[model samples]
Target: MPANPQAYRPETALLDLGDTFWDPVDAADFPATTLRFRNDAAAAEVGLDTLSDAEWTRHFGRFAPLPGTLPQPLALRYHGHQFRQYNPDIGDGRGFTFAPLRDGAGRLMDLGTKGSGQTPYSRFGDGRLTLKGGVREILATEMLEALHVPTSRTLSLIETGEDLVRGDEPSPTRSAVLVRLSHGHIRIGTFQRLAYHQDEAGMRALVGYVLRQLYGEDGDDPVRLLDLVVERTATLAARYMAAGFVHGVLNSDNINVTGESFDYGPWRFAPTWDPAFTAAYFDHAGLYAFGRQPEAIHWDVMQLAASLRLVAESDPLIETLQTFAPRYQAGIREAMFWRLGIRRFDDRRDHAVVQAVERVPRATDTPIDRFFFDWFGGHVPADYPDAFDELRRLLDPYTPRKDRDHPYWHGEPCSMLIDEVEAIWAPIAADDDWSRLHAKVAAIREMGAALA
Candidate 1:
């Protein structure tokens, strides 16, 4: 019943392409109110977000007036390797891609919502998401942005006047749907679904669609597409390691085929260097651990490759996958150096920084949060001999004391390291002092120029 339809395209480009289940229009059945609204600069780039509220509800939302904007209601279909085992019945269980929209910066982004109630894929479950889930996602996205990691931004959160049940927590809990602006919603499982169905044409069509939508400038070579995906994914993995982030659920269904970070469930920043740190309660085996992220990324990429084989199996695709390890390592190293605040890595200084921080015996299992917070305030200990001496002093109380030999204190310092680094980088992280840092770096460059 909306007059304009073109305005919704920016929001419709990212919808799942499989099945559509229409929501019946009755104000009582689907009473909605906007709780929060966010501007997704990433999504805006894709020529989306032009739709009016009525148009948005009509095309993306179920309860609408005339013929729906989208030709049909669609849910994405995909399979995934959950915790290293194949799970075929997983797709968008509680969420769906609405459409893509261009933001202020003109970047095309997916405007998708989580907890927007059920579809055929709901699988006899109450298709609702908790407010806590929405809160966690917002925090994770904000933190990732501050830490310079590429992630989806929370655009809006709408509390639907409904109660739903979930297996993890109490039932009859309040529910809210979250709209996130992301690069693309195409997941690795999407390809797998087509492969499992032996739909080569569909696979090819999907691949072509992704290439045009995300990497149109790269031309139409499927091998090139494979190479780019591997490179981007490898870089993303390295960034994750550098930031001490562990994506608890790295199932194929969760891995965005566009190589963007998607599905923020049970994700956490490391407190220590434990290769086995996991955020998901169900991940008893720690398949998506801190140290194993790179390998896990490779495994996911391989799954994508396998799916691609349904269309074309070639040496080039295999070769592209093989390049993942080296690229991943390089990306990790670069990201680590950046986080450590060492403009250039001098083996001596880098080791000294690492050792000095590691040696400051932690006194408690106190989180690394305070140390960084104090350091960002330019506070260091007088006892320590470094630029961050004041910060070290501030961190001393939290440092593990020799008398405190609890398990909590043992590996806590490693966790503190990231916080400490973030503290040192906070000025830059805040970006308010970038001009000054830039000027200082420039002055140093000038000194080198005079020396030369």
Candidate 2:
């Protein structure tokens, strides 16, 4: 007999950390709850796919508590540097951690909401999510996951019957509530808040809780933890570079302690290999531009190290921070080679390949996605530019893994360019036509499978 979906376990691990890290809040009373999109595949992993539409809406849309999980939604507290400026005023303003569950593999994961309601951190703005924004998030997560980025999975998106006015995009837009599943909601900012308040005990407690709940480890060694976080962040940065994804907001608070990418806003994929390609228009200085993502991520990791000083020695934490550069370089080398389907020969050849990857795309003005698609599995084109001679030579020894057999590779490469994004959203905005959205997601998944 098939196992019952409700048999999956729920966890209250975050609650044991105490109320200092969060505030209890009630979900907003929305005018209507219409399920816009449901990730049944993700639900199946967590044994929630068996729920009826009304049950799913009640749990995710209406924020009903799961048994033995979150008795109430929690607006988590933390401080972050927004655009490099220290800001103690930020937290989960319009969202909260709803509950935690164990997947089929018995790994702990969290279900958090965006634009669910207002909390103490809501600031002066009304707590609501524009439906367009939610749709964009769906697109971002789907594409990023297809590209193998360790990211939060979009579990559900429910359209709430309300009109929201926003500065960006068209005004009087529809609203929504988005649920995402990630390792856990705890962020680097969670540690920053404790460090800011000089709460050493709180820092220790937080570290212990994170090691147990998030990492599934017993020790709370901040130095060891920082090292692991640095490694993961390095890998994340490298993956973003290989995928040509610009996160737009690398704010310290936006980074999770688990090193997974979340909080999609003003994100964009590079059309070309231009280093200055930026996502958010407000990034006047290009602080979080495509090329500077590694720097931005490293800077956030440094702040995390600073936070760990409350419980660990500075020398050891600093030592861990130094590893970010080398680890990031290695990560980039591995990611690029994997995406290109080339086998690493030696240090020199790998270094040359990485340099060629950086140089060829920029010099050729090739769309980053097209470049990867064309050169996949070392299948260098016969008419390749003279500048690519060294790269082609380096790839000569490797056999092509992807012989362009995948249907997706036989045609145009799948990409998430800005204009394409606008085109996809236009029909949805005009007539609520989600057909294009569904089709695009299917295509992206096909591309992912091909790349894999």
Candidate 3:
């Protein structure tokens, strides 16, 4: 990692341009701020590694504006389709892009907050996050990152001195604000908002910014952008399938322009290989279920293509959108290989290796997480029930990573199963004992490092 160590190379790229994509909003000061979690890895990415706990709390927890960053956070504006219904009353109601800074790799990143406070978009609800929700997000990102999925990592979690009332959780739960570190906060909904109002100039400006900031190598052709987004979104869906994870909300607003998965809410990992596994309780039709993720993402990229029609013709966009199926199939095969720590030996063997994992899960009662853990690193234990015999032949051509010797590889896989997550949080909720939470986070990170 290379970087300038002193000050943040902050930019006012989006905010400086005024209210085209976002509205300047001030962060609300919490009554009392206590830092609950800090991501040192993310800190080093930007130039905030050496900041003391007091300083971190002052800036992130207290909502104090960064010295070299934006004067105020930007509450982004966007319209999205919620469960296939057009919803215009949606935007960054509770969160904002607090800062824009660069990393060691010189890629622009956003420090965004959730539960910071209410904005103009906040209709009638309080812009507060339950401590439970914050904890869940940390777990979601930690586990997903370890599995090599493109995702947002939690940077800071601070408990505010307030009790938030949530319908999904126990009443008057502890309130908290969360900051996440990610590549970009620009969403598919951003383009939709522009298109909704027929803001052709705004769409062009946003598209230009994305091309310059993210896909610099790709020329600023709208069709090329559509192609890039389709490929990425396809890969993203494949990763979710390979990881056995379900992002409960597949709304346009939840989909980011960078193709990095963020805004983890009601997320869950499948206990077993079930196609109908739905993460959100409100998903009555199973629209965003595990099996339908690829389809949902296909729909989303189409929406982006529709938005891009302001700059390009429909024929190229339609042609590019059709590539998602083949791309997704290829991506799933690739992701499976990465998860198992193997490289391609031959086309037959590679196909057999991927098929073994998919076919074995449906043929047996083995838990999905356990299936990957037991057979990962090219070691197919004998007890793996109903596993295809061809998998053994596939393993012969593959060499496992030496890092498999880690103790985590031998036991019941360190998993973020729903029961396990609840158990980890039970102590913190009742006794104010955060020992379990800390231990769990450490274990998750260790699992991530070893897996990577």
- The TM-score, computed over Cα atoms with residue i paired to residue i, of candidate 3 is 0.96
Higher-scoring candidate on lDDT, 1 or 3:
3
Per-model TM-score, in order, reads 0.70, 0.97, 0.96
Cα lDDT over the full model 1: 0.59
What is the per-residue lDDT of model 2 for residues 63-89, given as tens digits with 9 covering 90 to 100?
888777888999999998899999999
> Which RMSD does model 2 reach against the true structure?
1.7
* Candidate 1 TM-score, true structure as reference: 0.70
Model 2 worst lDDT run, 10 consecutive residues: 1-10
lDDT of 3 by residue, 1-452 (tens): 11344545776676644576788888777898988999887788888777788888887887677766788788989999889888989999999997788877878889999999999898997888889999999999988988889999999999998987778878889999999998888889988988899988888778878877876654568787788888888999999998999999999888987789999999999888788999999999999999899999889888999999988899999999999999998899889988887766777777777877776776786787777777777876886544557667668878765348777876568778889889978998899888888888888878777788
Per-model lDDT: 0.59, 0.89, 0.84
* Candidate 1, run of 10 with poorest lDDT: 20-29
Model 3: pairs clashing at backbone N, Cα or C within 3 Å: none
